[model samples]
Structure formats: C-alpha cells, structure tokens
Target chain A: MVSAGAGQAVDEGADSDPVIRVRGLENRFGSDIVHHRLDLDVRRGEILGVVGGSGTGKSVLMRSILGLLRPTGGRIEVFGQHLRDADDVREIMSHRAGVLFQDGALFSSLTVLENVELPLKTHRQDISTQLRRDLARSKIQLSGLPDSSSAKMPSDLSGGMRKRVALARALILEPELLFLDEPTAGLDPIGAAEFDGLLHALHRALGFTVFLITHDLDTLYAICDRVAVIAERKILAAATLRDIEDLDHEWIREYFHGPRARAVRDQTSPPG
Target chain B: MSDPAQMTEGRKDDNEADLVWERGTEGLLLATGDWVLDNVELLSDRVDALAGLASGLDASGISRLDASGALLLERLFHRTGQGPTAAGLRQQWRTLFEAVDFACDDTHEPAPASEAPWRQILERMGRSTVEVVHSTHELLGFLGITVHRLLRTVVQPRRLRLTSTVYHMERTGLDAVPLLILLSSLVGAVVAFLGATVLRNFGAELFVIDLVTFAFVREFGALLTAILLAGRTASAFCAQIGMMKLREEIDAIRTLGLDEIEVLVLPRLIALLITLPLLAFVATISGLFGGLIVSVVSLDINLVMFLDRVEQTVTLKHYLVGMIKAPMFAAVIALIGCLEGLRVSGTAQSLGEHTTLAVVRSLTMVIVLNALAAVYFMELGW
Candidate 1:
C-alpha cells in the first residue's frame, strides 16, 4: 500500500448507516467535467440499478465507488469507513464488495471452478481443496448455471454463461456491497431475463446492496429497488421503478412510461 | 440531515427516494474526484514501483537515468532530495496528490492521447520517446538489481533459486530441436557438397570430412541454431506476454498482490534457459548428419571414413565450447524476448512491433554472446 495522500474528506457516515453518501464529487480531465458536484446513495440491502445513455458517466461513477477509478475530488465511505486509494483494498473489501465485470472478467486460463474459487481462496485459506471446489460448485449452481458449466473457461462458456460465472464469482465472496457493470448489457431477452432472475435470487440470499449499472430497461424494473437514471452527468433521481414511472423528470417520463420501456417491461412483467 | 434551505437550492428539492438517489449519484462523483486529487502526490513520487519487479530477459549488466527527472519532480512535490535514493520521490508523489482536482466518483477515460499535448497529459509516456522506452535505464537495470538485491538479502536473509532453469530448458531447449536440426542439416549438406567441389581440383575431396566437422561442431551450427531459437521462441514469448500486458493482465495480477516475475516471466525464462542448450547440442548432431550425407556421396568418402574424420577433428573442447554457448545464448535470448515483450504497450500493432523487436534483440544478443564464447575458447587455444 502506498502512503496516505491529501484530499481526505470531512464527512464520515456511521456503520450500518444504510445510506452511502457522496459530497462535492467532481470528475474532470482538463476542461471537461463529466460529473459536477454529483451526490447519490444506495441504501443497505436495496438493489440500486444505474441507467444511463452511452457516455453518461454511469460506469465511471460505479468504478469510482468500487475504488477502481480514483475520483479527480470527494469521499467514498463504505459501511462507514474511509477507503484510501491503494492497490491492496481488494483484499480489505474481500468479502464486502463483489463486482461482476462487463466481460465477466473471469480468467481465460482458469476453469469456472478456479474462477469462482478465486475470492474464496483469498479470504478463506483454511478450507480443503475439495471443500473449495464444493463451495465453487455450489456458487456456480446458485448462479443458475448448469452442471456442465462448472468446468468451462470464460471462452468456452457462452456470453450468458460468462455473465453467470462472473455472478458466481461475485456471489462466492458473499459480499455485502455488489457492483455489476452492465450485468445484462449484452445478453438476449431470455438470457437477460434469466440473468435478472439470478440477481433477484442473489440479493434475496445475500441481503446485500447491489450497485447495478445497466442500459437494460426490463432489468431495472425487475430487480432494482431504486433505479437511478444517469443522464447529463447527474442522477435524474434514485427511486423505485414505480416512483420512477410517476416522476416528472422529462427523461424519466419518457424512459419509464416511454414506448420502449413499456414494450420491454410488458414481456418480463411477473404474473399479476 | 435534510436541510430545508438546501432543499430550496432545488438540488435538495426532492423526496427521500429522490434525495437518496441524487445524494448517492452526486456524492459518488465528489468522493472519487476527491480521492484522486488527494493522491496527486503520486506524480511527484518519482519512485517507479515496477522498477525491480521484472526479470529473466532484460538484465544487460548496465544502468542509466539521470536524477534530473527527480529534480523536476521535487519542484512539483515541494521537496529537496537529501540524496538520490532518499524518500523525496515518494513524498513528492503524495504532496502532488494534494493538488489535483478529482471527481468524487468519476474515472472517465481521458480524451484520446492525440488530443492532449505536453503540459496537459499525465500519461507516463507524456514525456519524450526515450523517456517512454527507458531503454538506457532498463539496459542498466542489471546493476540496480545487483545492488538492490545485495542490500535486501543482507538486511533480511533470502534464498535465491535458479528453479526456472528447467522450464527455459524445456520451452526453448526441447522445443527448438526439430527446426534447429532441419536447418543445420541443410547447411552442413550444402557446405560439404560445395567444399568437396572446390577441393576436387586438388584431388583431396575427402578432406571435406574435416571441413564439415570443423564447420558444424566448432562454430556456425550452434550459433545458427541459437539465432533461430531466439527468433522463434524468444520473440514469441515477448509478444505474447507484451499483449497480455496491454490487456491489463499485468495490472490485474499486481492488484491481486502477485509478483509479475514469479507469476509470468520466471516460467518463460526457465523454459528458455533449459531448452536452448539442448537445442544447440541437437543442432550440432544434425549438422554432422548432413555433412555425412555429402561425405558418403560427392566426396567419395565412405560413412566409416567420414565418421573417423569427424571423431578426430572434433574434440571434447569443441563440444564443450558449443554447449557452453547454448546456456548463455539461452539466457540472452530469453532475457531479450522477455524484455521486448514487457516493453510493449498500446494497440495490437505495438504487440507485433515488440515481438519483432524481441526476435531481433534476442538474435543480436545470441550472436554477441557466441562471439564472446568463441574469443574465450580461442584464448584458451582450444
């Protein structure tokens, strides 16, 4: 870990605070400011999906929270502790924050067993190899992947399978804070829906906060406790899908009750 | 925590759901930007973390880089170095982090490199071409390593292993046999035929047996095989690893707290070191086979006579000299291949270029080492 640097923020939220706070967050490169004093929070145990158009700074914000990107100003306190920028925070947040990368980020060299076992290996060093395998297998099965999927590489697995494998890795750690960068961004309707189902099950099973970033409308409606419509470098509003439907924000009205949103929502709508 | 006056700012003008949403989004931006600005101290921290993490292919017994960059960086960090290795560089990196304006929770990709000129870019390559390649610095790294390791092991005792010795032997040594044999055999057969023709007028064509043995075993055969393996295996290792680097696999490993040398380069270095000598030995045998073909035919020297002559002309010293060349050649080739591979950055095109450079550098290094071995052997009058 590198030495502590400047720009430490003043605000510190409490443990079990439920809300993640952001203050005076500004991201810029040269003269361009992508985020200007943006602020938002995902309450504990809520599935918060962030929706945005291309280049709307949705993923950037997600990366920032995950500490993947250093903020250009501001503070990110997770479960009420300051996470200084360093290379080793992944180990610190080991089982606390699970991330499902866009490409699934599963190692090409590793089989599914090995990939899911990665986080488990980092945290629980005492488990037998067979126990680790069993844990990974269970995570894979919990991810809704078929039995045949456990041995596959990221390349060997289908796109949906890759996403599931990523989800499996995320779940393997049983993190309290989950970040998914476009979990169903590239999947087909059926594939995407199934993936969304897996997310619902994961949230229910883990009782964790899901910081979900996506462009998928149906997924937002299906799983997100509050969908934050990211547009113009700001969160349009973070609210439940039902609240989003009634919102007066121009994009919100058009986005939620919009024809496109309605068409996607109708298909995946659960039985009345 | 909800203030009515702030609510009137229209920013606070929202329900808990909206307030919660807005705060989460806006706060994220603030926190991330703040973290980076606070960390700008890194720019001044002239200590490149990766300096000592590499191994196998790049050790050239040289060290370069003036502390001039340190002077410039110190100004940024507001520090004066007590000495070159003082903690000034790291302190500057921290203090500089204090100055940047960071987005709370944003890490947008900066605009394309072409759009940003110097004085605007923080990219490491933002300096000059030489600054980016660090060629002189890297070439000189052998000294840095020797000194650094010497100090470290003494301060805290450590064990060193040439364990990768076997791996390089396999990848570079074993895998190189078929090609080295094929190429050297052809060279020997062609040389034998041509030598026999030239000697015919003297009515001493059978002496071509001596020519073949001396030529293949003592000199060119082993060198040629080394060059070929350097081109094929060494270059391939560089390009492959370089591409993986560009893809952020290197960063991923580092983030996971793994050493790049032990995890990636050592295995390759081991493969090359172990394999090259084996390949060289094979090349000499194959070249002799090719020479025997001509001795049996064009030179009118029977197989038995040719064998006798080769046995006579080539001594244990000749075999030992070539074998000696193989491991050194292996080390050089592996080192150069790995060096060029790690040097690759940017697009897929850079990977190709680095691969080519790896091959070229390895071949050049192999030739240089071969020459050194030759001179050393000649000095011994063997």
Candidate 2:
C-alpha cells in the first residue's frame, strides 16, 4: 500500500501545491544565530525529512513553522494561509496539524487513553463522551497499541510504546499535517524499523503531509520522500535522496557518503 | 440545477467543502471543495445521515482530499456496505482510503471494568500501609548509614565535606537567626505580659519574672525554634533533595561510587546539629531579654531586680533542659526532610507532595519528641 501511494505521490509531485512555504527564516538567541535566510517548501502529501548535525537548529525550524516559536525573520504560509498575520489561519492550522515531540511529552499524570482523548475534548466539545472514547480507542488501535495499554501511565510503558502512545495522541484529531521530532531516536534497531514501517503505513493510510526531523540515516532512506539538510546556519539542500547524496559540499560529502550512510543505503532498496 | 456548471457555481458561495445529497433519480452524493481534516467534522453528520440513502458517492468536484477526509469516506462506505460509485478520487486518495478500510476493521476491545470504589479504597489503604512501613525501614537504614559515615569522617577529617557543611550552616542556621530571634522575642513578651496580668490579681506581680524565665528557658524557646525550623529548613531540604532526585543527580552520585549518604545527607545532618544548639541558646537569651523588657516596662520592675528575681526563682536545670532537646530536634528534622527527599519519584507533583510531607512529618515528630523529653526530664527531677 505504501509503495503504491509513494509512486503516485512522486508522479504527482510536479503539479502538487506547496502545503508549507517558508522563506527568509531566521532564528537567533542573543549572540547565537541558529538559522539565517533558510527557505524550504513542503509539498502536499509528501514526507519531508529534516536532518542536520547537532546544534544546527532543525528542531527550531520545525518549532517556528508550527507557530510555537516566533522566528526573528520569516514568512511562513501553511495551506496558502500566512501564520503570523492571521488568527483564523493559525487556528485552522492547529486543527489540521499534530506534533509528536521527542520523549513523547505525554502527561505523566494522565493515562494513555486520557492523553489521546485530550485533543478531542479540546477541539470537539460537542461530541458525546461515549463517542469521544470510541474515537480515542480507535486512534490508539490505529497506532498499533493494545487495548490493555489504554489504562496504563506513560511511565509504565517502554520507550517505543511511549512513542506509540504519543503518536496515537497526535493522530487523535485526524490531522492532515503531522510533525515528528526524532520519532525513532532511542529505539533499538528492530523497534526503529518497526516504527518506521508504522509511520509509513499511517502516512499511506492518512495521506497527511509529514515534516519529520531525524538524525537516523535509515529513516531518511526508508520513509522520506525528500530530505532537507541544514548546515552552516541555513538549509543547505532540499531534494530527493538521490540528489541530496550527490550534493558537492564538505559536510554533505562526509554525511551522505560516510560509512553509516553507506550501510543504510546498502541495507535498504534504492528509493523509488 | 442539474448542470455541472451550476453545481460548481453554487459551491463558490460556501467556502467550506461539503457533502451534498441529491434525492433525484440519480440518487447521488456529491463531495465538493477541499475535503481535508479541517472540514471533516463539518461533513461527518451529513455523511452519516445520507450514507444509507445515497445509491452512489461522487467526488468529481473535490479540489482536495487528504487522509482524514478519505478515512471519513471509508468509514461511510464501511457502514453502508457500498463501494464508492463514480467518486473519481485521485489515485493517492483512493489508496489511502483503501488502507484506512483495511486498518479500521479490527476495533479495540472494551477496557477492563474498574474496581469498586470501596475495594479500591481498601486496596489503596493496604498498599499505603505497606509503603509506610517500607519507607520507615528505609529511613532508619539511611539514618544509620549517615551516622556511620559521620563517624568515619570524624576519624579521618580529610574525608569530611567541611565546605558543604559550613555552607549549609550559613544557609539553615545563620540566615534563620533574625526570624528566630524575632519570633522568640515576640512570644516571650506575649507570655510575660499574660503571666503578669494574671499574677497581679494575687498581688504577686514580681513572680511574672520567674514564670517568663522558666517557660522560655525550659520549653518555649527550644520547642518554638524546632517547630519553625521544621517548617522552614526541613521543607527547603526536601525540595532541594527532591529536585536532585528528579534530575537523576542522586543516581549519578550512586553510579559514580560515591556514598549518597556521605555526600548528601551527612553535610545537612552535621550542619543542623551544629546550628540547632546555637539557635536554641540564642532563642533562650532573646526570650529572657524579651521577658526582662516586659517586666521592666509593664511591671515597673528594674532590670537588676528582674534578673535577681529570675535567678532566685528559676534554676540552671531549666536552661539545661531546653538546650538538651535542640540536637534531638535537629536530628529528627534533618532525617525527616532528607528521607522525604529520597522518597521522591519522577514528576513535579511528587516533589511538591514530598516537600509538604517533610514539613508535616518533621513538625509532628519534633512536638512528640519534645513532649517525651519533658516527661523524662520531669521524672528525673531536672
């Protein structure tokens, strides 16, 4: 199913509209500059993998696009609506977007089911309680979590399961745009692969545009439709993996042609 | 109205995409506009109402269709047991809808039934009782380890954390001096004024000096200072330790092969031991001074006469009794605070709960120990 959709998305790439348009993005912390004149476009229905070395501010860019941080200079347009100038656009974007933070960020006090139900309760206040529970339960199952995990605390779950619960919570709203920050960072090899597969399956099922920040080369190879590299205080390149790997830059050369990248490429089939 | 141009023209008036049902011979359901997550809620009720009636679903006019919208259509088709007819959904959207249909088939089982309220309460009570016993055991073990480490450090002075001890003494003791002095003075003056007013009725106004001296020196000074420190320093200790535990710094110390008791608990305990006695002495002096001032101002007794009366009526045993309880109170306060801190688990709520528990436990223990000491001293004819 994912292969079929991936082919279709690639075929339709030329005519697809840009869902997220970022231009002249700048982020600064006093004397420290994180991003400067960064520009990137996330097309509709594509998984855009964001990668950078440590301290390169990939997460900051995601935060700025998500409206969590006000960039020092940038104009961000999501779904053809400017984020900063319009309140209605922001509200619509929020309803349409979901973010899975690193560490799951699940409320330690609330059970998994309650965590998944929180967004529904906030956004759809008129839904009946039983209907809300049903929706939340479906989302949890959709994330491949067992029904038994619904009542358990976040602290009780393993790191992978916690990430699944966070995914369920993020998807509870049936969002059209999903932001994932290092979705498989701390998982073991098998768990990371399973998570990647789950993410691919969900994206195929949901058709949501994904903006994923990751350091894992395998994730970029296995799932991303296009990879964006950040370096030297700006987005160095944003292209298909084939194009990104062939880029002529010092850090890009070492990163994409490195032993780890070679291992990842050798392990996985070439991108479609 | 049947013309496709007219239908497209009508959609321009409504900015939001919607599912429109036609009950004519075609019996068609028309999906128009952007069918995305933002508008799925708007379409859900209408889709549910018309799903059973429509013979065919058409999406020829849809400008956009995302996973959420596709999922809704899949759910509608699943419920009505009808495949979409002439929908003309984009290839990507059709694949997504198919996936949703395949995935949503396995619904989750119902959650387990909750336990009865009375049973839950009883179970919680039993668990808490066990937890209390375990915590007490842990506290005693920690106290023993702390004492052992202190003894070892005393024998080998280089091993002692002298700098940390002095820093804590300045924080918990010296910083507390003004508040302690002020509180003891006010309480002493209040006691003396109250005693003199009552004793004047019996023409024994001069006896107020003896009353003030005895109570302040024997009970009020030590007890009040202990209670105040328990509320103030003990809660601070709990918060500091709880934060460290939450940050895993305590775990780091353990992994580094350093004794947590020696590093964390011993410095605090020793600082309290040194400070509490000194604070107690200061409390006794300030309290007596308060009493002397009250006697001089209110009773018109000269300073020398008030001192002479206190010397004649109150014995050195009273001062000794007050000072003797200081170290014990200090140990209890420090132990309870540090114990509660070590008990902290993950979460800010846990830190807050342990801090409150620290203050309450220390205050209660100090009062109970003071009463027990008073009884013992009384029996010993002190």
Candidate 3:
C-alpha cells in the first residue's frame, strides 16, 4: 500500500513530543554552507535512520545535536531542554546518550573490558570497582562478545569485533538515547546483517531511542522504524520506508528506487 | 508526568532508590526507587546489604530501572543462589532484567599469575639479546639488497628515478644548508676564540688559523654535517616510510611489480650520497670563513697572512680525509632509516619507536665510523 508521492513535506507528525528537536539549524565552514535552516525531530523509542549522499552534512548534523559541533545558528533541544553550548548541559546530554562512531573509536591501549568500564568509572565514582567490572562484563556479553575477548587490546581484534567492543562501551552507561554514525559501513554483508540483527534485538529489549546514520539500504529496511532523507541542505523527507519510497524527490527517488534498493526491498518485503 | 524523560528525571531523587523488607514470615523484599546508572551507587549499596537474601523479590515498588540497575539486581540473584523471577516486576522491567540476566555471566576469570622477579629479569635479558642479534642480521640483509639494487641501477641507467632523487636532494641537502652553515660557523668561531686564547699565552697567536682550518677540514666539517643529517634527514626518512608502510602504500608498490627498495629507498640513498659530500664542502668553507673573521678581528692576523698560513700548513690530504667520510656517513644514515622504516609493524606506536631507533642507530654508527676513520688516518700518518 505504497501511495505515489505521499511524503512531500519534511515535517514529523508524531503525537508525542520528540526526544530530540532541531530548529533553524545552520552549519557553515568558511563560505561553504553544509546545512541551512534544517529542522527535524527524533521521536522517542524509534530507530530513525538518517540517509544522505556523501558530504551532505549527515555527520555534521549529528555532531551539532550531540553538542560536539556548535551550529552556526540553531536551536537544539534534548529531553525538552535547550542546549546552550555550556559544558554542564553537554555533560548532562552526554550522560543520557551513547554514541557509536564509525571505525569504533575504541582506545587502542585499553583492553575491551577496561574500555567499557571507563565510562562507569568516570560518571559514577561512588560505584565499587567490583560492580563496575560486573557491569562492563554484562555490557560486553550483551554486545555478543565472548568473555575471552574482554582482556584483548583493541588493536588485536578484527574490525567487526572492534565495532562490537565500541557498542558495548556505548551501552555500558545504559543511555536513554543512542547515536550511531555509519555503524555498518565497512562490514561484510553477512557481518553487517548480523550487526543489524544484534542492534534490533538490543533496541527492542532496551527500548531506547536510536538515531542511526547509515548508507546501507538493508540496515535501513531491517531496523529503522522511519527513514529521514537529508538533501539540498535540509531534511528532504522523514517518514517510514514505504512512505519515503514514493516521495516525489530526486535524491529520494534515485536512492530508494535504485537497483541495490530494489534488491533490499525484495529481500525485506513479502511476495505481492 | 506522562513523559518518560520527565519521569526518569523525577526518579533521580536519592530517597527513591530504597530497599525495605520484613526479616520474618512474609519473605517480601520490596525494592523501591530509580535503579538506573545515576542511582547505581545508592542502589548497589542497598543491594550489597541484602546480598544473600533468599526472599521472593517484589520489585513492584521499584520506580525506575535501566540496564545497569538490572545488572545489579542480577548480581543479587547470583549471590542468593536463585534466578530472578518476573512474578512481581513490571513488564518492561522484567524484559530489561531478562536481557541483562541472559548475558550476565558473573564468574570472573582470575588474573594470570606473575612469575618470579629473577626469572622475569633473565627472560627479558635473553629476549633482548636475541632481538639485537636478529636486528643485526636483518640490517645486513637489507644492506645486501640495497647494494644489489644500486649495482643494478648503475648498469641500467634508465632504472634510476631522477625526479625523486632530485626532490630528496633538495630536501635533505638544499633545505639543510642554512642550518649547517649557521652551526658550523658558530663552532668555527668558538674554536678560533679558544685557540687564540691558548696560543696568545705562548706568543704564537698565528697558530690559531692552523688550529681552526685543520679542525674544520679534517674532522669538524664532515662530523658536524653528518651528525646534523642524522638528526634531520634520517628521522624524516624513517617517519615517511613508516607511515607509508603503515598505510600499506609500500605493499601497493610491491603489488604493482615495483621494487620498494628501488622506488622508496634508492632515491633517498642516492640523494643523501650526492648531497652529503656537497654539504660537507659547504660546511668546510663556512667554517673557514668563521675562522677568518675571528682571526682578523681578534687575533690581529691579516686576511692574506691567515690564508697564507692555511695554505702552508693544511695539506690536500686533510681535506680528502674529511671529504671521504661524508658519503660513508650518508650511506649509513640512509640505510638505517630505511631499514627501521621497513621493520615497522602495523601500529602508530611502532612507527614512533622505529623513527626513534633510526635516529639513535644512525647517530651511533656515524660517530663509531668517524672514530675508526680517525684511527686509520693517524696510523697511515696522513
């Protein structure tokens, strides 16, 4: 029941107020403007998949909302409070959110368990060391890593395993919101699918809001409750896969109707 | 109140995370408050007190719970010798608890035991000795490869990369000229000052010219230039090639049927060989000029007399003695840098370590070779 040209506007029509809100967002480096007056909302407890062509400022947008990059001009609200570019507000936001950067970004020196335990130690110093280790171990187990991998350094692990370690570290604090930047960009197809499945399971079980940036159509189809298409310096459309697939837009039409997209669609959808 | 975010914030109050129970009859253990990451210290403290309680956990009184909290609850269950039941928990809390419980294997792997200190020291010393021997062998092998490649290029002139050689020559030679001149001139002036001071006591101040010219020509010029290159160019070569190897660029050249030695090492080596001797010559001239200025200004030695003195005493044999060591020093420095770079193994740390080793080894070899050359020249009575 995919209606043609159904998702034309960039507005979100969810009943509940969103967990993250961006309004009049503008990002500029020198004379080159990456984003201008970009407005979007990330609803509570939904995997909002963000898709864009390379250098379309998908990462810049994520950074701005997460307070890593201060937008040139914009209002960003997380958990119903305006972000003021202050350290305290950023600290509070950091506690509530976990980010999985592309390439994992695990500290090369620290072991997998130490890397995961670090956040708990930093945020909650009053928690005993034993409890911290146990929590880190649980997070590692939830990340689908064998307990043996816990003592190994990040440099010794494969790229996939490193990503899992990063995920475990991200989930250790049990954040209310999660941000993933190109989480499946470099994995093999099977590995990417398995990661997607793991993410889906965790999302369901934890019930936390997810803001995922990805170019993988399979990942978008597999886990995203809604897809937000960023193009032309703003969010072109933000809607479910079926709704966005029928949008009368150039990038969206090309992206969702491409040969690869067709294959992903066939694999994800049932027979007509 | 309907907002989960607001509810979570509200549950952050310290009093919300409390555990209450009757010691007898009911076995009803009530867990209250926010059981999240922020309240973990308090929750864990409360949980530790009831560590081995074999009571039916009625977590219905719990206001909030997250993964960290659920993991803490699972720890309590493990201690109590019972699996957590969903009987008295909310549906969402039950799911979270199950997710954590399914993954939480609380049995820790004991730390590996340490060896005796003496045994450890012995093992380390043996390992280092083996490493030194292995490194020397590898260095000899790399030298053989480089020599073979150089001979091949000598036979087939077209195989030499002229552009790369010139580029490196400009970098390692031309760019280094000003610093070399500055340091050599300063050293020459200092030597003249000291010599003049000592000779004036004997009323033989004219001998300062001989001292300055002889020191610069036979020893200081070549030694100083080589030492400077050891610091500057050798480290540069090591870091450049180490980064290339780290990024697999060296491997890419090999896959393309190109010899990395020919493509990467030969140019740097040839450039240093050509430029080092030239730099030594420049350093010699600058050093003499420094001596000339000091002698004229301080020692009252006329320019003509100073030149005449240098011409009379310092023979062509001394210049040859100094110039001969430049190419030798250049080869050692270039080879050590390239060999250390080629040995880098897949980490930024390794690159840093190899770069440092390149500089230290090249500096040591330069000084050692210079000392041997000095002894030989003295024995031959040059």
Q: What is the TM-score of each predicted model, taking all chains together?
A: 0.43, 0.81, 0.90
Local lDDT at A169 for model 1: 87
Shift of residue A168 alpha carbon in model 3, Å: 2.2
Report clash pairs, candidate 2: A206-B67
- In candidate 2, position A40 carries an lDDT of 80
- Alpha carbon lDDT of each predicted model: 0.63, 0.83, 0.86
List chain A TM-scores, every candidate, in order. 0.87, 0.92, 0.95
The collision pairs in model 3 are B16-B33
Span of ten consecutive residues with least summed lDDT in model 1 chain A: A1-10
- Best DockQ among the predictions, by candidate number: 3
Q: What is the TM-score of chain B alone in each candidate?
A: 0.59, 0.77, 0.84
Candidates 1 onward: DockQ, in order: 0.02, 0.32, 0.66
Worst 10 residues of 1 chain B by lDDT: B28-37
Error of 2 at A241 (Å): 2.1
For candidate 3, write residues A1-272 as lDDT tens digits.
11123344534465457888888899999999999888888889999999999999999999898888888998988988888976846676668899999999998879898999998888878888887887888889898888778889998998889899999999988888999999998899999999999899899888899999999999999999988888888887778888788778888879999999999999989789
